[model samples]
Target chain A: MAGLLRRDMLGVALTVAAIMLPVAGAQAADPIKVGVTITQSPPGSVVQGTQVKDGLEVAAKIINDAGGVDGRKIELVIEDTQGLPEKARAAVEKLATRDKVVAITGEHQSSAALAGIEVAHRYKIPYINTNGWSDVIREKGYPEVFNPGNYNSRVGAAAAATMKELGVKRVVSIAENTDYGIGLAKAIGEALKKIAPDVQYKYETLDRASKDFLPAILPMRANAPDAIINLMLPPAAYIMMNQLYEQGVAPSAKTWLYDGSGLADYPDFWQNVKEAGKGMLVFGLYHPKMAQPALGKQVGEAYTAKTKNEPNRLLFQAADSLFLIADAIKRAKSTDSGALIKALGETKYTGTRGEITFSKDKGYAFNQWLDVPYVTFQLTEVNQKVGDSALVSQAGQPLDPAKLWKPAK
Target chain B: MSGIDVDLAVNGLITGVFYALMAIGLSLIFGILKIVNFAHGEFYMVGAYAYTLIALALGVPVWIALPLAFVVGALLGWLTERTLMRPLYAGYTSWGLMRDEYAVIVTFGLSLFLINFVDKVIGPYAYRGPPLVETSRVVLGPVLISGHRLLAAGIAIAVIAVTAALIKWSFWGQQIRAVSQNRLGASLAGIDTAKASVIVFMLSGGLAAFAGALLSPVINASPDVGIFPAIKSYIIVVLGGMGSVPGAIIASLFLGVIESFGAVYISFQYRDAFGLILLMLFLLFRPQGLFGEKGREV
Candidate 1:
């Protein structure tokens, strides 16, 4: 009877061991899935979306080609947001619940990002914000949410400093009616009050979808400000610039055209706005002259090779987002949401931009890389690339007024 | 006022002219069919894409692409009438019993389908159609307008004039007018009512598409680019009276100038709101509009 019992126990142990072997092998071979949400269709900035997608793909290829994390491949499951808030919400929910993505990333629009993070927070998934600029995103205080992108306050402070250097007494900002635009516009107002107290400033909110902005721009013709700041994105920004130039408002001898939205990096910028972009001051996040980390150079080279287009700021931000997620997964050694979140919090990864580390402070500083670098530049000629443009100032540096160029009246 | 004010006024008027072109087609459709063509904007969108893709992608010249855009719009209009609109007047010869609700739903759905389809197929990036002239800017008195805009405006005016004349004196024009007035009576008088509706839809679609092609360089062609123009067209149709082309033209210019001046004087933030407010006032007080006939209930 003892011998028969021993045989049965041995058989049960063999069966258990056989089941565990395949499960372990499958774990080693399975790919880590990362979800990306972007506006691939109408009503969104497809230009920005395409750039983000390209950057993410390039980074994914680099990881996979390098044997991936722990010998497992990185697979991107992309969902098109169409730049709608409801679509973003649904997409994040679907990605987290059904696709079982380890991390959620690649949201460019602020409104869409705002909606997407809510779902990510609910699911306790790590969200790496790619390009949403609104400070309100970080202020939401979601532990799962992390930002490695430019912020509105950063651009606002830069614009204020540029305006002060240009000796502009009066300024006007034409902002699109969105969270990013309006938030930046307000931030500029606040920053101006602090840095240039005597400077007069105001902002006008324009519908992002509306083509006509003449009425808003025409009023400025009579009492043109010293500088007209653009807080809108393309193609609306392109239209506004054209109309402003046509009316001889900005980029003229009297008034300077300042683009706070960083419009100079877009590939279509020159094609749409020919002469309107000349002599325009831009709040740029990426410039060739600006100091970048070694990782940034590698990512830039990879992006240029893959897309055959100049690497812009969005590319670095998007690449860093994916790279950071992959790094956290590696550190965690598991795709569990709890473990990944803890690993992401302790990240000191040197991504494409800089040594990115999330802040522990509350509000807008929460989970944000507080010292993201930026620069201000000027487009001295038509169809000028950001690489060749005149770099007016570096991060936290003073703009040299002598180096600036203005149109002759 | 500064020289810039005059420039704004002239540019505003030019924009108004394009708006009139789009609005007139919508007005005509409403006049004849008594139903708003919600897909009117899609027709314009198609024309813009057709002109841009043909000129840029296929290496066709700008002039040839412009006319081709019109043809594309007309064909789309014809197809829309044959497939979707036929159900409205298919079995019923009588005018009063036409399925107006069905027409609205079909056109609205068609509009959605076209927008999404373009987004999926052509991609969503806005392509600025090549200009007729390569000249970037030309100074005309106080105004400094793009050379392409000046030339396009001239063509638009000529096309609008030709459309008005065709609708007034041509044989088909008279039949269309008769059908719009009293479809049953026109049918009894040996006029082919169905044929007239087809012609009107085609003309309307063609004109809107022509406007889209002409302005594509300035507006840039995208999947939902036609939405703004369609809204403005709806407002112009109501302001000019439901079916009057001349009324639409006058109203378009007036709205444009008012919006331009109001935006500057009141608040630039509410520039689009001015049109909506005007529309509301017109609906509340004068539903018949500036040139519309008073209701005569039978």
Candidate 2:
């Protein structure tokens, strides 16, 4: 009886192996799908969305060209969120449930990212935040969420340090009323309090949808601050800058205009602002003159060739997002959510920008890349390209005020 | 008054001039059809693109480009009326019952289509039209304004005056007023009501487009650039009295000044809220508006 039972168990084990091996082989041949949520329509930052989409496409191409991850090609399933939170939530739901993407990434708006992460967390999918800078996103502390791009706290510290070096007594930030804008504004204030406690700082929130900002700008004419930081995105930023110039506010001899929103690298910056952009200082994530990794150089060249436009920070941030996902898949050796999450946490891969590693620390540092490189530059002339702009400061260097330019009032 | 006050007033008035240009068209549409043209803003957007692309891409002079924008808007207005709007009043017996709903849906759909069409076709990047003047700043006492803004404001006044004159005296304008007053009566009196409707739409489109072309330098032309101006125009039309041209002009200036002062004294964040508050109050207490008759029948 014992010999008969042993033979039966052996026969069942052999049958299971025969059934599972072919299914596993077939699955390995299928492409790995990654989900992207971005604004492709009006009322959102379509410019930023387009740049991110282009970067992701370039990265996917490069990955596939290098024989892909274990012979499986990368496929991206994209959805237009139009930069709305509700739409983003629905998009993530659809992608995770219907499309069955392994990992979700490429969200540029903070509100959208915040909404998307909830669904991603619920489904236990790995979520790489591309460019949502709000600190609240980090504070949520979801195990599934990882940030390899810039954050509001990082920019706030940078802006404060630059303001201190410039020796500005009074500074004002004209921030748009959004999670990214308001969070960055508050971050700047907190950083200023630590670095330069005596520096008078305040932020005014403006409606992003409103075209005319003269009313918000007009009062500043009577008492212009030593430095005015622009925390709004275009074309609202462009409108505000023009109005400020017309009202003789900032970028003048008495006041310094600094852009913390990385507006200098936008393709439409010069055409939209024209003379108003001259003499403005910009906080940038990517500069042509800045030293970058070889991967960064390749991505930048590919982006320029593809779009006939200059490489921007969004392009690099977005590329890094995709590369990190591919790297995780390769390390994990499986498309399973738990395995991918574990691999991503342990990642120490060098990406397009630089070495990226997710922080296990709590609060804003949780799952965040803490040491992203940045630079300060000045647009010295009208229609000045980001490459041609004066790089006043590079990563780990103090902003040089002498390198700055002021408009003759 | 303080220098800021002087600056605010001048800026407000200048802003009001542009608002009047947008609101007048909306008012005209409301007068004839008794239904708002939700796509009225797209007319303005089309004009902006027409003026900017004509001048920048085609190398046309800014002066010619500006008027050409108006003509383009008029043509769009004509097309919209002939193709989409004609179904409401022209021989469709079942459609007459759903005229108001049909107008709303059609116009709203047109607005979305135009915005996305422009976004996909022309690309999402914004383009600033060349200013009419090169002078950046022109200071008059405490008021320091941009040369282009001051010039544009002057042109807006002239256009508004001419539009008012034509509407008050022109033969076509009289026919339009007749149709707006009583569509059934006007048709019975051999007023050629369809012709009047077409003319109103064309004129409405032209004015809104002219405003867009004039302000493109200041606002920068983008796909959703028309949305804000459209909202403001709606508020102005209601405050000034629906379908009243003079009321729209007066209400626009009033709202602009109120916003300017309120932004400084009350709160800059609530500046836009002031218009909405006024709109709400008007709807609740006086829905007839400042110049609108409460109820009129043939």
Top-scoring candidate (DockQ)? 2
Candidate 1 clash pair list: none
Screening candidate 2 with a backbone cut-off below 3 angstroms (N, C-alpha, C), the clashing residue pairs are none
lDDT of 1 by residue, A1-409 (tens): 9999999999999999999999999989898999999988778888899989998998898899999998999999999998899999999999999999999999999999999999999999999999999999999999999998988888888899999999989999999999999999999999999999999999999999988787777668778999999999988998888878866888899999999887899988887788889999988889988888988898899988887899999999999999999999899998899999899999899987779999999977888898898888899999899999998888888998778999988
* Candidate 2 per-residue lDDT over residues A153-267, each given as its tens digit: 9999999999999999999999999999999999999999999999999999999998899888877888899999999999899999999988889789999999999999888
Off by over 4 Å in 2: A1-25, B92-98, B296-298
The TM-score, computed over Cα atoms with residue i paired to residue i, of candidate 2 is: 0.96
Model 2, span B1-298: residue lDDT tens: 8888888898888888899988999999988877789998899999899999999999999999999999999999999999999887785222235357788899999999999999999999999999999898899998988999999999999999999999889998888888877787777888887788789999999998989999999999999998988899999999988899999999999988988888888988899999999999999999878898887442
Q: Given candidate 1, what's the lDDT at residue B293?
A: 78
Per-candidate TM-scores read 0.93, 0.96
Candidate 1 lDDT, B154-235, residue by residue in tens: 8988998998999899999999999888888888899988888888888889988988899888888888998988999999
Question: How far off is residue B109 in model 1, in Å?
Answer: 3.4
Give fnat of each prediction, in order: 0.58, 0.87
Model 2, residue A112: displacement in angstroms?
A: 0.8
Looking at model 2, residue A316 earns an lDDT score of: 96
**What interface-residue Cα RMSD does candidate 1 give after superposition?**
2.3
Clashes of each: 0, 0
